[model samples]
Target: MAHREPVVVTDEPTIGKLVVDASRDVSGLIQKEIALAKSELRVSVKAGGLSIGLFAGAAFLGLLAIIMLSVAIAHFISFTGLDLAWGFLIVFFLYVLLAGLLAFVGLKKVKKVRPPEKAIGQAKAIPGAFKGKS
Candidate 1:
C-alpha cells in the first residue's frame, strides 16, 4: 500500500476552513457515538430476549414436571387397591398441603428480603457529598 503525505493546516487558516474542519469532526464524532450506542443496544436486546425465551421454556417444563408428578402420585396411590376417584382425591389433598407449604416458604423468603439499607444510605449521602464539594 502506498502511504500518502499528511496535509497540514497553516496557523493563518481561513475562517471557512476552520468552520468546515470543526463541523466535519463534530459530525464524525456524533456518527461514531451513534454507531457504538446502536451496537450496544443490539447486543443487550438480543441477550435480554434470549433470557426471556429461556425463562419461558423453563416455566413450561416446570409445569410439565408438576403434571407428571401428580400423575405418578395418583398411580402410586391407586396401587394400594383404592378406586381411581379416591386416589385422585388423595392427590388433590396432597397438592393442597404442598401449596400451603410453598406459600409459607414464599412468605418467609419475602420477610427475609429487606431493603438494601446501607446502599440506600450511601446513595443518599452522595448528593450531600456533592453539595459540600461544590
Candidate 2:
C-alpha cells in the first residue's frame, strides 16, 4: 500500500470574511451585467441606425416614383390634343383641390377631439384627497 498524506481540515470562514467576499462577488456580477447590457445596446443602436437609413432611401425612391407618375399622367392628358401646359395646369389644380379636401377633413377630425374631463376632475380632487378630505 502506498503511503498517504494526512488531510488537514481548514477552519470555517468568519462571518465578516464571508460577507465581504459575498459583497465583492455581487459587485463583480453587477459590473459584468452592465458591460453585457452595454455591448447588446451598441449592436442594437447600430442596427437601428442602419434601418433608419434604409427607410429614408426607400422614402426618397418612392417620392421619385410619384413625381415620374405625375409627369406621365400629364403627358397622357396632352396626347388627347390638349395643350401640354394645360395638362400640367390641370394636374396642379387637382393637387390643390386634394389638399383643400384633406385640410377640411382634418379640421373636422380635430374639432371632434375633446379634453379628458374625467382625468381633469380626478386631478382637481388630488389636493383635497391629500388633505384627508374625501
Candidate 3:
C-alpha cells in the first residue's frame, strides 16, 4: 500500500516535454538499430541460401557430366577403330586440357569480382583515411 511521487506536473511542461522528446529520440534510435539488424540478417540468410542452391546445382550438373562423359568415351571406343586403352587415354587428356582452360578462365573471373564498397563505406574511417579529413 505505497504511492509513488507524481513524475509529471501539469503547470510545468518543460521537463515533461524534454523527457518526451528524449524518449522519442531513444525509441527512434532503437527502431533504426532493429531495422538494420533485420536487414543484415536477411542479407546473410539470402547469401547462405544462394550458396547452398548453387552447390546443389553444381553437384547435379557434375554428376550428369560424368555420366555423359562415360557414354561418350564408350561410343568413341565402339564406333571408332581405335583401341580401347588409347581411346580412353585420348579422352582423358582432352578432359584434362579442358579442365585446365576452364580453371584459368575461372581464376580470371574470380579476380575481377571485387567486393562491393557499400559495406566498407559504412566502416569507421581509419587513421590513414581520416588524416586529410581532420
Candidate 4:
C-alpha cells in the first residue's frame, strides 16, 4: 500500500490585499505604458528633426536655383532689347505676384487644419472607462 501525504489548502486573499495588488499592478502597467509612449515619441521627434533639416537644405538649394534662374531671365530680357533696369523691374514684379499667390494658397491650407478628433474623443472617454461605464 502506498502512503499519501496530507494536503493543505491556503485561504483566499482578503479584499483589501486583492485591491492593493490590483492597484499596484495597474499603476505599474500605466508606468510601463508611459515609458513606451516616451520611447516612441523620442524616435518620432528625432525623425521629425532630421526631416526638417533635410527640408531646410532642400529649401536653401531651391533658393539658390531661383536666384540663378532670375538672373538668367533678366539677361534674356535685356538681350531682347529691353533696358537692363527694366528687365530687373519686370522680374521683381513677377516675383511679387507669385509671392501673393503662394501666400493666399498657404493661408487657405492653414485654415483647414483641425485638431485630432479621434484622439480627443478617446481622451474624453478615459474617465468614463475607469468608472466601468463604457
Candidate 5:
C-alpha cells in the first residue's frame, strides 16, 4: 500500500489550518462511508426482498395444501355416522377454536414487544460523550 505523507507539526501551523485539514478529512470519511452503506444496502435489500417473496409464495401454497387436507378430514368425519353438514361443522368449530387461541397468543407476544432499551441508552450516551460530559 502507498504511504500517506506524515503531518508536520510546527510552530508555524495555525489553528485555522489544523481545523481545515480536520474538516476535509472528516468530510471525505463521511462520503466514503455513505457510498459503502449505499452499495451494501442495495445488495441487502435485493436479497431480502427476493427471499421474502419466495417465502410468501411457499406459505401460500402451504395454506392451500392445509385447506385441502382439512376438507379431507371433514369427509372422513362424515363417514363416522354423523351427517355431512355436522362433520364439516365439527371441523369448522375446531378451526375457529384454533384461530381464537392463536389470536390470543399473538396479542400477548405483541404486547411484550417494547422499544429496545439497550440501543436507546447507547444512542443517548453519544451526545453526552461528544459534549465531554460523560
Candidate 6:
C-alpha cells in the first residue's frame, strides 16, 4: 500500500476576506436604512417649517397692518375733515374684511394639505414585517 497525502486548495476565499466582505454589505444596508429614515423625517420637518413660517409672516403682517391703519385713519381725520370716530369705524371694518379674507385663504390651503403618502405606506409595511413571526 502506498501512502497518499491530501492536497490543499488555495483558491477559496479565506474567513477573514469573507468577514470583511460581509461587513461591507452590512454597512451598505445600514446606510440605506439611515437614508430612508432621513427622507421620511424630511417631509414632516419641511411641512412644519412652512407652517411656522407662514404663522410668523401672518403675525408680522398683522403688526404692519395695525400701523398702516392707524396712519390712514389719522390722515383721514386731518385731511378729509372726517371725525376720528368715523375714521376709526371705517378702518376697523376694513381690517375686519381683510382679516376674514386672509383667514379664508389660509384655511383653504391648510385643508388642501393631505397627510403624506409615506405615512400610509409605512402603516401598510408594519404589519408585513411580523406576519410570519407568530
lDDT of 6 by residue, 39-63 (tens): 9899999999999999999999999
Q: lDDT per prediction? A: 0.93, 0.96, 0.86, 0.97, 0.95, 0.88
Which candidate, 1 or 4, has the higher lDDT?
Answer: 4
lDDT of 5 at 27: 100
Candidate 1 residue pairs in clash (backbone atoms < 3 Å) = none
Ranked candidates (lDDT, high to low)? 4, 2, 5, 1, 6, 3
Candidate 1 structure quality by residue, lDDT tens digits, 34-111: 999999999999999999999999999999998998888888889999987888899999889999999999999999
Count the clashes in each prediction: 0, 0, 0, 0, 0, 0
Q: Which has the greatest TM-score?
A: 2
Which stretches of candidate 4 lie above 4 Å from their native place? 1-11, 97-134
Candidate 2 per-residue C-alpha lDDT over 1-134 given as tens digits, one digit per residue, 9 for 90 to 100 = 99999998889898999999999999999999999999999999999999999999999999999888878889999999999898899888888999999999999999999999999999999999999999
lDDT of candidate 4 vs native?
0.97
Instruction: Assess the local accuracy of residue 111 in candidate 3 as a C-alpha lDDT between 0 and 100.
Output: 95
Instruction: Report the lDDT of model 4 for residue 48.
Output: 100
What is the Cα-based TM-score of model 4? 0.60
Ten consecutive residues with minimal summed lDDT in candidate 5?
7-16
Q: After superposing candidate 2, which stretches have Cα over 4 Å from the reference?
A: 1-10
Off by over 4 Å in 6: 1-72, 132-134
Candidate 6 similarity to native, TM-score: 0.44
lDDT of 5 by residue, 22-46 (tens): 9999999999999999999999999
- Per residue, candidate 4 scores C-alpha lDDT tens digits across 33-127 of 99999999999999999999999999999999999999889989999999989899999999999999999999999999999999999999999
Q: Model 4: which ten-residue window has the lowest total lDDT?
A: 5-14
The CA lDDT at 19 in model 5 is: 98
Residue 118 in model 3: shift from native, Å? Answer: 21
**Candidates sorted on TM-score, descending:** 2, 1, 4, 5, 3, 6
Residue range with the least summed lDDT across 10 consecutive positions in model 2 = 66-75
Q: What lDDT would candidate 6 get against the real structure? A: 0.88
TM-score for predicted model 5 compared with the true structure:
0.56
How far does residue 96 in candidate 1 sit from its true spot (Å)?
1.5
